[model samples]
Target: MDQTTLLLFIAATFVVAGFVKGVIGLGLPTIAVGILGVVMAPAQAAALLVIPNLVTNSWQLSGPKLKAIALRLWPMLAGTCLGTWAGAGLLEKAKDGSATLWLGVALVLYALVGLKAAKLRVPAAHEAWLGPVVGVLTGVSTAATGVFVLPAVPYLQALGFEKEELVQALGLSFIVSTVALAFGLIGAGALDWTIAGASLLALLPALAGMGVGQAIRQRISAATFKLCFFAGLLALGCYLVLRAMG
Candidate 1:
């Protein structure tokens, strides 16, 4: 794609991504990276994700529960960082197609789980062992696919956090994962100033779309929208998988 075309497509991607996030409170990076992977290399798509994911998640983390959540989740966060760092090494050595394949697989799995309304519970005492394991897997997934909602989200849900607390915890985990993923991308030499600059600029459209989505959310049923969103993701995932196989 030409420069202008690439820029417009990326901006559009984030707008859609942000709109979804505003409506349901998550999925910005996953949506963006998933769609963009169709047009570009996966590492490049991942590089484009760094700035928006970090900034938005940081804003989300500003809620009052930040400190307590951070304190409680530090061990998991540390394990995530280590896993991302290690996974980056693998990503650096692999072909871009591998990343794209992983992204597709993740989208399919996440969509299926969401559609099923799957839930699990973990006793508080088990968190110390379980959290780090989930964190490591989430980090590795992030490094491989630039999508971070795996065992992490499920594990967090299992922890029995209240709604608001869960939101804040998700934000904190995304922030930590985004930061770690950025470092991983850098270490793999997948990030450079050009992509970083474009990523920074994409924030405007994302936030604007968020505003639009927030307004829409007031009138529409979120459950319906989320169902539509997951359906789209499933279709997109299928396409990506097929293309990769070809």
Candidate 2:
């Protein structure tokens, strides 16, 4: 892509990604990577996501709930950091179309469960053991695919969090995942100043789109937004799967 085209693409991609995140409280990385991956290399795409992901999620993390949520999530957060470090090695060694395939599979599974509106409950007793396990999986997936929702989102859902709490938890989880992924990318030499600068620039458009999405959220039902979200995920998943196969 030329300079003009690349600028346009970045503007458009973040607008869409941020809108989704504004509405659903997550999906920035998934949407950004899914769209940008079509036109660029995976490592570069992942690198571009680092700054925006961290910045947005940090905003989402600020609230009275922050401390409570952090206490609740410390174990998972720790596991995620470790897993991302390990998974970075996997990313470095990835061959064929494994990264795309993994991303495709993760999207499809996430969409299916979301579309079904499945309500899974984890007994409190299970959370200590399960949360870390899920975090590790989410970290590995994020490192390899630049998509961080997988087991993390589902596990959060299973906790039966109130809607607001769920949103906060998602923010916290994503913040940790983004930081971990950035470190992983830096270690792998996938993140550099140029991509980081571009990523920082993308933040404005993303924040602007979030403003628009937040307005729309007031007018539309959450159920409607969720339906659209899952539908989009399904289509994106199919595209990724086919692209990998082709």
Candidate 3:
């Protein structure tokens, strides 16, 4: 394919990905990779998500929100760093089925455990493990099943965060994942100029989508959001399995 065509396609995909993320606060990587994986390798698809995720979420930084939650998420961030380092080696050795198979398994358990967990009020000290857990998965899967971060939300709510604080936390996590992912990809020598340029250009669509998503989020209820998000993720997981199997 020509440069223009590839650019157009990626831009379109990024826009949709950004919209989902903008509205739901967590679909950028999940939606983008599912589509990009159809055309590119998972590694390449991952490279595209890094910068955009960082850029969009960074725009969300309110003074009090950043100050308050960034401190609380410190433990999780440290865990994320460690998890990124450790998970990189395993990711290199891990083959096709590992992520999709486990993600499917994780999804089932998420349905069972996560439902109960989301309803309870858990303290931060108790659920602190979520960061490293999310980081390891994000690092390895390149954000494929990075929705692992989503489950941590219930625990955050249990800790009694308002909507803005919750949004900030999720946005900040995306920033951290983007940075960790950048380093991981660089170590793997996945950071060529062609991909970098493409990724930079792709941000335009991502920004546009984020605008649309922010607007949509207001119309949806939390339960409806979770249900729709789960259904979308299930379909994504199934598609990944088929791709790996084929």
Candidate 4:
């Protein structure tokens, strides 16, 4: 495909993905990776996703509940940095390993669990160790698999947090993962200026979709929102598996 057509298609996907994440607090990678995987390497997909992730989560961070979430989730953020570093390192160094399959499986499982979890709420308190564990998985996934945002969501949901709290947590987690993944991708020499430009261009759609998402938030039932989110995850997983098989 030509550059303009590819960019338009990618932009449309970004809008939908942002809308979904705006409404649902997840699906940034599920949407970006699933579609972009067909057209680019996983590294490119990740690079394309970085700015949008930053922008979307930055909006989410302004919520009134954001401070509380920051206080509660700092451990996880710290842990994510370490976990991501380790995970990214292993993927980078392990010559025989295929991180793509791991990413696919995680995406499918996350969708399944998250879909079921939409009925519940985010927890007020979660395990201290959970952050580092999920963070590592998330980081490694991004470095090797391109979907590092997965490990944080289901567990956070099971913790029974408020809706806004949940959104902020997911948003924050993705932003953190994006940072780690950017570093990993950079260290691996996979970052690109053209793709970074594309990601920046996506900021408008990201914000626009977030506006739609916020508007839809009141109307969205947790079950329906989760169902759509998980469905996207499943579809993305299948696509990843197929790509690996190919």
lDDT of 1 at 37: 85
lDDT of each: 0.84, 0.84, 0.65, 0.71
| Predicted candidate 1 versus true structure: per-residue lDDT over 51-78, tens digit per residue | 8888777666767777888899998998
Task: Give the C-alpha lDDT of model 2.
Answer: 0.84
Q: Please list all clashing residue pairs in model 4, or write none if there are none.
A: 83-136, 122-160, 122-161, 123-159, 123-160, 123-161
Between candidates 1 and 3, the one scoring higher on TM-score is 1
Error of 1 at 170 (Å): 0.8
Show model 4 residue runs off by greater than 4 Å: 63-68, 89-99, 118-126, 219-222
lDDT of 3 by residue, 1-246 (tens): 688898788899999889877776776776786677666665677777767877877865665768868877776666665666555533333456454554444454444443444456655666567655644544444433433344444444566777788777777766776787667666766666777887787888999988987888888786676676667666666666666666
What are the per-residue Cα lDDT tens digits for candidate 4 across 1-246? 999999788887788877887776677777777677667666677777878887777766668877878777777777777766665544444343255566677788877776665554433444666666666666556667777656676657666677777777777777887888777766766666876787798778767877788799888696677777788788888777766766
Model 2 clash pairs?
none
The worst-scoring run of ten residues by lDDT in candidate 4 lies at 89-98
Model 2: per-residue Cα lDDT over 1-246, one tens digit each: 799998899789999998988877888888888888788766677888887888888766666777888898888888898888888955555657778877888888989999999889999998798878988888888888888888888888888877777778888898888889898888888887887898899898888878788888889999988998999898998898899989
Cα RMSD for candidate 3?
A: 3.5
Residue 10's lDDT in candidate 4: 82
lDDT of 3: 0.65
